[model samples]
Target chain A: MSMKRLESRTALVTGGSRGIGAAIVRRLWSEGAKVHFTYRAAEDQAREVIASCGGAVSASALDVTDAVACEAVVDEATEKLGGLDIVVNNAGIIRDGLFLSMEDTDWAEVIETNLGGVFRICRAACRQMLMQGGGSIVNVSSIVGELGGVGQANYAASKGALNALTRSLAAELGPKGVRVNAVAPGMVRTDMTGAVRAVAAEKILERIPLGRFAEPEEIASAVAFLASDDAKYLTGQVVTVDGGLSLLGRR
Target chain B: MQNEKSDILKTVTTVIAQALKVDEAQVQPGSSLIRDLGAESIDFLDIVFRLEKAFKIKIPKGELFPEKLLTDARFVQEGKVTAAGLEELKKRLSGADWTQFEKNPQVSSLGDLFTVGMIVEYLSGKLAATNR
Candidate 1:
């Protein structure tokens, strides 16, 4: 629907430098949200995202793994945007390796950034939300988190735990007016998935009922719906936008 | 002691009134927070948050309202407070009028002990220690 559902809303999109996070930034901004995005190291790409919005959306540097940094970034976003109405936890990382061969650092780093970062951001944002009496949190999870990919054990574990955390917090915070939800995208065309898709593009395409991978925009649309008043009644839901791939069965 | 007690009650009444969204007149010293003031589990947290800010004191989780207290075996048995439980409550809770509760100390009625008076009594002790 072509509606400005998020008009005048304040939003913080993490890792909004490229791909799905970038598309989400553009989408939320298009829907009339005053957007503040965060980028880790993609200064050039981050600038291009700002340019895409004609300098409307703002951005800052953030490493989600730093607990103190996460709180500071959230505080700044809340202050700069006037108030934090929506928080999209889209920053994540993957260390792909077979479970048996996976190094401790691989598991720890993936868990630290993907899961711990979300925990920190959500904790800080929820305080602001609780004081304001309500807000929305949309976590960007993955279909592999549910299907459990062969070489994505650490990533899957983090995402799975994230889904649980989302549900638990939704129940805890719903009474206080904050809604928490997750969007699980499958095989989106992003640099993060480029390594795996190059080797198994045909195999993955065959598994998906739609016969093609998702566009970043497709995932962004779902994030927008969850972040907006359009999905006010929806909370604690891990809505999978995977072109019916999940229905086919686990990998 | 009576004058100081009344002063604490006035402030406690205001905090509880705001937290529970009730009129100050409605929140009496004897009124039960849940039974009279329409409080639920979520409202307890709201009350705790407001109480901490109102009193300017930290209230660690489970200090004011320990959700798992009655569930413990030493304190309760078969849906009733045991003798040990009564003794524990007598020591920990100075605000409850245990004479009424002693007749039939059902665990369900444990929440009744957490009255506005109980909160005031707890805060009285807390603030006294802090001021000292």
Candidate 2:
């Protein structure tokens, strides 16, 4: 048997129960990395992902918003998986509303989960990675962060801050042999987008020059590439998988 | 005994100079680690790691720097370190001078308290405790 791409490596993906996160978990596992994934409320789905992967994939329930919990999860994953080589910060929440109508709770919840959670986890993981000499971190950002969605002010702000965080951490940790990058996914066929797709399928498809929504696996492939040695020199860059939606410019 | 203390100070200065990428002569006994030596938050971790390797002793977080003091409300009041905080710092860093830190007790200036002599004293005490 030929050696797999991620053989002997270990990965931890946050919010890996479904959608692009689940696909990333599967892809990393398929590449032969020992994977431990986290889910907030989808225990059964998380278990199913582990069962399907069939090798070293495992699942745990974690609330990314909790700083102590995030630290514990990183420590636990590193201990169990034997060493953390890759970290995918895919855990985020979306609260859609106009900026004026958005409640303080909505803004705080989204920011705490999406941006602050990444901060906590990355801080903990970087400690371990620095001690070990090298590692890679892939943050799951969104095109809304760059382009700004009409009803997603909170989500947009959170992901926008995430991109800045990715760039800053990349510069700080680069000398320590750690790499940080972000993936800004656009119009993926996830359960969250299914409701919007039903309402504005054609309108949404018109913006994408690709003329189709991206499957979760396609985004996962980009994430897997960034996490692999093939992208050893890539850092502080945001790879947009938006099917040219961003290129349309304010459409 | 005086020679041993001077030797420990020289070794501590060398380790800190190497960690911060500064010349040994630039790291004076009274020079502040942050203000004078340009050691930032991340640089603290590198310095600690290098100090551990150079001295062959463990320096736990919050022992040498006391990060927890930064969070305590009683120790930090009105965005600055209170007189109480300076008392705690005096106890923790008994070997170094605290006159400048006392004169300017703003929390932002807390890093200014960490002089090269302070690190030498902290590591010397740690080594003494371990050896004893």
Candidate 3:
């Protein structure tokens, strides 16, 4: 099938150097959105993604944790694309530790990169979007934020704040023609969860009614929809892609 | 000094109240800022900034808040830290031998704590010193 659904739009995905983020870059490109992505430390991976993607993408070195750097990246992407229409705040990190044992640096770093970084990007994007009439933002939150995980207290709190931030931004920007949403995927097979024990994976799979971890493309497809015209009516929503894990306990 | 302490407590309570969306009276020195008061991390940051502006102080960044207090989600969850405890932590932070504290891995939250009034007082001192 022709995947040109997103033709004529320009998209930027942070953390697009590898794994789920790289998959998102590819999917948006396939759907005909000119794409730009950023990586803090993955120079080779970022270059490789762009090189292999058939020449309509750009990748930059950016540490999303820095508010100034985030604004610059948005500026550069909008400059390259002439104007930006979609932004995917996919860049994040996990500083896992139980709350009791977690270090101050651990909590601050995760909050800075994951939650504060999203705020910086969204703020910059909103300014640009408002000037340009409108845009769409797809922030990548995690299932851990909603369900809460034991060892991922910092990660969960960051993601939880991102969820709240998403709602607040949507409320403020929706009237300006900008749409803000989040995709909270559970147990997606990515480098972020590379160490998941087989037993643990099985346990989670059982919890998911679909009984499997999602491929990166599955999550990317949802992102594409949110960034497209079809989803114009949807804002301030988190479309969970955990295959019913969140619904298992429901009657 | 006692009156000053009361004033600090009242000012800090008002900042916390504004951030927590509660009545100012609900924010007594012993009132729970997080749990009974329902303050989140952002609220903590917000009140910290307000306290700085109100009293004129600069709290150091980078885990300056002691480990124990930082990890206690109960500040928002249980609301258990007493005003006296908060004051003691503040005093300890003032005399904090940064070198000794950094070398010790004992991880006492009392050592790294930074409260609204503490920052307010620090800023006040700085402004006074500069004026001199």
Q: Pick the lDDT winner.
A: 1
Query: For candidate 2, lDDT tens digit of each residue in A155-206?
Result: 9999999999999999998877899999999999998788779998999899
Tell me chain A's TM-score in each of the predictions.
0.98, 0.98, 0.96
Runs in model 3 lying further than 4 Å from the true structure: A1-3, A197-199, A249-251, B1-132
Q: Residue pairs in steric clash, candidate 1?
A: none
Best by TM-score: 1
Relative to the true structure, how large is the alpha-carbon lDDT of every model?
Answer: 0.90, 0.89, 0.76
Please identify which of the two predictions, 1 or 2, would achieve the higher DockQ against the true structure.
1
* Winner by DockQ between candidate 3 and candidate 1: 1
lDDT of 1 by residue, B18-70 (tens): 66668999999999998898878777877777777667799877778877677
lDDT of 1 by residue, A179-226 (tens): 999999998999999999999999888889998999999999999999
What proportion of true contacts does candidate 2 retain?
0.00
TM-score of chain B of 1: 0.88
List clashing residue pairs in candidate 3.
B34-B75, B34-B76, B35-B76, B56-B123, B57-B123, B65-B112, B66-B112, B66-B113, B68-B109
TM-score of 2: 0.76
